[model samples]
Target: MRGVTELLRPVWRTLPWPSLGAGSAAGLLLAGMARLYPENFDPWLALNTLRTAALAFALGLAFLLDDPARHTTATVPVPRFVRQSLRLALVAPIAALWWTATVLLIPAELRPPVGATTLEAGAACALALAGSAAWIRRSQEPEPGVSVAAGLLTVAVLAALLLPDDWELLVAVGDPGWDAAHGRWGVLLGAAVGGWLISTREPART
Candidate 1:
């Protein structure tokens, strides 16, 4: 009701619409690629997208939750942790809807294995929650050089994603398609670390 609406107001105001739009576009492009290049319709692609979105959502939520400016008014009293947890909870159903819609749009043959889909979604949610919690805990007393490190890490992650795919490297190591799988997880972990560093460095003041 009113309480729920009020709690979400700040999150809505600070929502990263640009990033979200970019992600949605990227997802559509990937899906279209699968359709156009049926021969290259690998399940790994879907897994990568799922994991990346999961991680990104988690990082975004952490940033939004930890922003002190969101709680400028003292009139409303609400625990930060409670608000963050509720936001995380809301992402699940939305994710499910996204998954359903994505499936309906893609060719039947391009659909990912159900188990893999479930695993990736679960990993995304778990990593995001863990990242947000870590960020909140660290925000209590942050160190001086952490922000720089976080910025560097973020750049590194982008670089990794932009690198050309190496099938030979993937197979030589018996990784098969794990590069996409593990890479997404690595990005999530890096994002979590960055969020933790940022959250720890800034003191919460209302």
Candidate 2:
């Protein structure tokens, strides 16, 4: 136990606690402001704001590996997966707590279905981290969140504008597409996990 604790201390110390805190604060503020406007708030409106906040906060999560030492660390005797596993270990609980708090922040009467909405949040979070992982693998940029954020926003805008009605990912509650949209969310989450795993692999030898 002591051996494991010693191994993780360096990784934990380097984790971006500030960005995570900012993301949680931003999500909470959005949820709280929506609660203040209960008169105009509906389930659909609540879902929209909550989903947007989750995605916005995930932008911060994308910075998890944004270290000036990533390239140097990559060459260390420790395995890449070991280092990243430690990073995830440290953040997973905080992320779960943040999600729970985000859900609770919604007014009870207007809250979206927790299970379905959580699937969306999970997918969004995975996509953000996967994007950053891909960036680090390909570009080796110590800090890649800036481009990841821009790319994420671009993809979101295009998804909203270009996707046809039948295949839309974000649909209003009670719409026929709601269940189908979440079905796609499941697929998205799977793809993102796969991407992250692949991206985190050590680079090939020339």
Candidate 3:
């Protein structure tokens, strides 16, 4: 347990930039694309991008927390689950900070509906954190062939969820317009999963 904690410390320090970069890039691209197609784009779509970026950031933090590098000294005294919980606890505030910054960076007109956006951002953060915890606790690194299979399965599931029927289903739940507002949920989800996988698994010792 001490070892795991020690291993994760360095990851926590260094992994923030890459995750922030990915989230920012994803957010900016979505915003840019919306601007390009003003006639077709709904301004509210920016909110989705912001929410997605927040989730990506949260997931990235989770990966950093789980990195084997941060666990070195961790074995001395701490129980593994306790350490893991401590790391997970950090995700909420960091995600909140990221969301605050993101909201500040957006143009007033392009920002999400005020109070609702905050709630959505918080929800995304929670989802990302929960998902990462689940993955870390239950999943293992797959063999090459299995990895490919898993990737394919993820794609299939995403497609099924984002396709026309899926859109209709979401609409049935509430707001059919939301399905058409932003189509980047799949990309955000993929980023969260990929970032978690890449960050948490052991890398060659540096």
TM-score for each predicted model, relative to the true structure: 0.54, 0.93, 0.50
Assess the local accuracy of residue 28 in candidate 1 as a C-alpha lDDT between 0 and 100.
57
Task: List model 2 lDDT by residue over 81-170, tens digit each.
Answer: 667767877888988998898888899988888998889889888888889889988885898877887788788889989999877999
Model 2: residues with Cα > 4 Å off, grouped in runs: 1-4
Q: What's the TM for model 2?
A: 0.93
Q: Would you list the C-alpha lDDT of every candidate in the order shown?
A: 0.49, 0.83, 0.48
Instruction: Please tell me which model should have the higher lDDT, number 1 or number 2.
Output: 2
Whichever of 2 and 3 has more TM-score, that candidate is 2
- Residues 116-159, candidate 3: write the lDDT tens digits: 55544444444454455445544442212223324433643575
| RMSD to native, candidate 1 | 7.4
Model 3 worst lDDT window (10 residues)? 141-150
Runs in model 3 lying further than 4 Å from the true structure: 1-17, 28-41, 70-74, 88-93, 139-206
Ranking by TM-score: 2, 1, 3
Worst 10 residues of 1 by lDDT: 166-175
RMSD of each: 7.4, 1.7, 8.6
How much is the lDDT of residue 163 in candidate 3?
70
